[model samples]
Target: MTQLALCVMLVSEIGCNRDGLVICYVVIPPPDQQWGIKLPNDTWTGMMGQLDRQEVDMALGPFTMTPQRASVCDFSVPLHHENFAIITPRPKLQSDVLGFIKPFTVQVWLLILTSLLSVATAMGCVVWAEGKIFRHSEKNIVARAFLWVFCTVTQESSHWLPKKDGSRIIVSFWLLASLVFMSSYSGILTAMLTLPRVTVTIDSLADLVSQSALPWRLETGAAILTYLKESKEEVHQKAYRNMGPTIYALLRERQAVAEGKIAVICDETSMKKAMDLDFSTTGQCHLYIAQGKVMTNAMMSLAFRKNSKYLVQANHRVRILLESGLWHKWIGKQVANSSHCLRHPRLDRREGIQPLNLESFTGPVLILLTGATVSLLVFLCEHLSHLYVQPPKSTA
Candidate 1:
């Protein structure tokens, strides 16, 4: 029987109802992998995608039943829900550091400022180079002059322009100016980019490793763990060769942080769970390295063969799941209880009793207001169109 019909039938039978039978095959995602496993089509979209494509009967993992996804596939009355968190090596500062930064860290205003500064500086330099002083200089108006100026400003050598009389004066001063401005500009750009990297270090496992060189536990074959082991092996390190698969037995198996283990495993949401569990890993985790590090999040969805009824049904299911309040309930469970909070008074203060505003309601509220304005305009237009089409009611 199709997983969809089977599901309906199961639900129906359990509820003491006799319904018509409709059997259909469904493709299910195996729970073997962390992010959704791949189907025969060689695509992975987590469990939901597998089910939508009929690759699997239905995805039963802790798939997020987002409203957007519901428009594509049905989620089975939300299995689990959690918030995203980054785990890094513990910071050197007091535990309240995150509490402080969370309020006013690098925000949209900061990004906009940096972008404006970079663009303005780049344009200013370009304009200065093309200005009257350099343009009206008594040097020969050769293409080589332009190339020389451009190359010098960008810190590249100009092989075509020799050290001739006219080229000497212009080249010397221009090169000097470019060096000073370029150096200053570069410093600012570097600082802007590195600030976020440093702050978001907790977001990546490698960043944690670089910051703290302690052994961390990870499930066998996990992508993050695999990447770490591969990189470590490439350097021919003997200690990491086989430091045993598990971490200190005292730590929770799925939990990244606990009483004994120094690190945590699982996706971003799981990190939040650790804090919710009253685990004390927060404030300690830090970025693994300061340079040449990289990490990416998981992205996948259900597959479909063009337009199909199954696809439509799957999307509808996703919508219902998201709107049903199951996802939020799941998240509440993960964070509501904290063992650590009860044991340590100071830790509770950092976490605080005040509720967290997870979604940043400002953006969505503005968007909703804008949408309502547009929708009102559309409705007005439709009403006017209907009146115009009715040919002056009863004038005849």
Candidate 2:
């Protein structure tokens, strides 16, 4: 789409008739032969090499603009700009039956606990001072205050509320805070149990490189590999170090990612293509593009041989197409073609309407078993003690 638009722009700029303009693709079946322009000895190689040899007038695609690529061929103003998106297996769903605790972080839970303890202690102390220091009729004021506060935590009704204004004020604030916690926790936990909980295992390029869980691969002869190999940054260096063997084709490897065998480091174009193809073909979305970007400096433009006569005109035409919004429209059109499967981003999210089954609630099942076992043990111990205390009142 972009190429056709650029072709029309070029023709219009030169005031040449549409028939006079010619566009041809140097077709190569080998995926490896289509990308990267570098090699010691080259005789009519990939698009980059063909550009360098001046065999082809221009090469198109998201031809990444790098210093190494720039030294061989002149690039028009970058037409498409992007960073590589990591494609990996979705992180496993958390069925931690105790996932009820997950609605709040550890710090938040601790804060709640601290607040509860502080309020209970203060209530007990204040009540103690009132009954002990002053002539107030009270029995076990400290124990009763603690019990009332504990009961409040469980939402249990109690008749024992403080009579004094200061005590009542403290209780009121505690009630408000507890209500807030309960409302938020219940809403979140319900949503969690019903909806899919997506855990973004890899949020950045560094996260992908630092983790050794899944072996990651790159496309053979990709400029991303070249960028990583030559990059001075630690994350890129580590990514290069940890990169698995390169594959000529990326589509076949999508299954590997789905099966949790490997991850693919690819640009958004390839990522979306794979995702759409997988979903369209299988009717299931097993692949996901991570939210991380590998290289933010990557650019796409028309690649012309060094000092090619068309470089100046091509840049002008490219600029006109970009400014006129034709380029973005074409890109958007291409992306919109795969509108069928819209996989939510982050940790391989599923459709929002997927209802979890009993098997999925492994955490809750385990809790139930533990509770049953504890009850059985307590019942056995109680029976044993009863028999010891009153010998069953001998039948004889």
Candidate 3:
């Protein structure tokens, strides 16, 4: 309803014959605008009357389906989904990683907790190794401990190990600590590699609430907001906002806006990206969908005034152009070419996404080296301890 402010046309000559005869003129719609145009209702009402009389070829705008409008004009199947949202403001916060993990499902929460635990365990092992080996003062204990962690976990080269003359027990413990660190790190890495990545699953407004108590956010001008507000369930469940300022506030706060608390109010695609779905959200979020069951999944068709088969044929050609998948292929290549555009730049790039090197380990060598190292260290510790620390002569 909002995209019909002005009209212009391009006139061109038709034939190569020496005679100059302009055959057709192509009318172009005006630039898009939201508000600030003034016109009386009768002006548009009269235009529609003329359109019914075939005085005009067509009118294009956001014209949703209704019985009255259908009587006067034919409509194309909806081009996309026009789902509503409940937008609200985000809140301020300090760094508590648990805030994100706590509201999710068991699997999601487990992954988050496991990551934290791995980091904590690695830090602990490094601290133990540093204290046991280095004669460094406790004043610089934290710095040295972190350096050991940096070298060991990442397998970086460092000359930090104590001389062989140092206490054998402490050396043995460093070996033990390294084994523990690698085992724990590798276990988590394996779990991650084996699991399939998550994708966007929420499709409908109802699905949002069904999955969790996350609040929905809607913009003031969003067409779906009006429809959602009319529905008793949606109106009660969702929160509406004028813009992103308030929406961001609720998201950061982790509270539902319905009860005047902050929560994330984003479209499904945005949610998917935040949750690491298949692809990043970049294209159009709003869509126009046909309501009737028969037209469900139907391609959005362009309508023409009655008895104009030419326009219908032209629309069909456009549909064929769209469905050929050339556009999809082109978009995919562009994204791959700029792989940096995707999230997790350091993670694996299975899609030929450019230069970010994935975490590389020679699989067989890594596994064998890890196993042999752990076994050698454990056996050496047990054998040496048995030989040196003799059972105290029973003073019997």
lDDT of each: 0.42, 0.72, 0.38
Task: Quote the positional error of residue 4 for candidate 3 in Å.
Answer: 13
Give candidate 1 misplaced runs (Cα > 4 Å): 1-56, 62-207, 221-256, 279-311, 338-396
Instruction: Give per-candidate clash totals.
Output: 39, 1, 26
lDDT of 1 by residue, 1-396 (tens): 112223343333223312445444544434543333334565544444455555654443334334444554544433233332234333332222233223333774365346434443443444445545455333443444455556665688766543344435555555666677667666754443233212333434334444444454543323344344445453223323533364322124434343334444444444444445334445432222112223333332333333444444555554454478554454555545433332322222323333335333444466678999999999999999998877655755
Q: For candidate 2, list the clashing residue pairs, or say none.
A: 97-363
lDDT of 3 by residue, 101-121 (tens): 223458854664574345445
Ordered from best to worst lDDT, the candidate numbers read 2, 1, 3
- The true-versus-predicted C-alpha distance at residue 88 of model 3, in Å, is 11
What tens-digit string does per-residue lDDT give for candidate 2 at 91-172? 6555555576788999999998898888999998777666665667778777887888777876889999876666788899
lDDT of 3 at 63: 36
Q: How high is each candidate's TM-score?
A: 0.32, 0.69, 0.31
User: How far is 174's C-alpha from truth in model 1 (Å)?
Assistant: 47
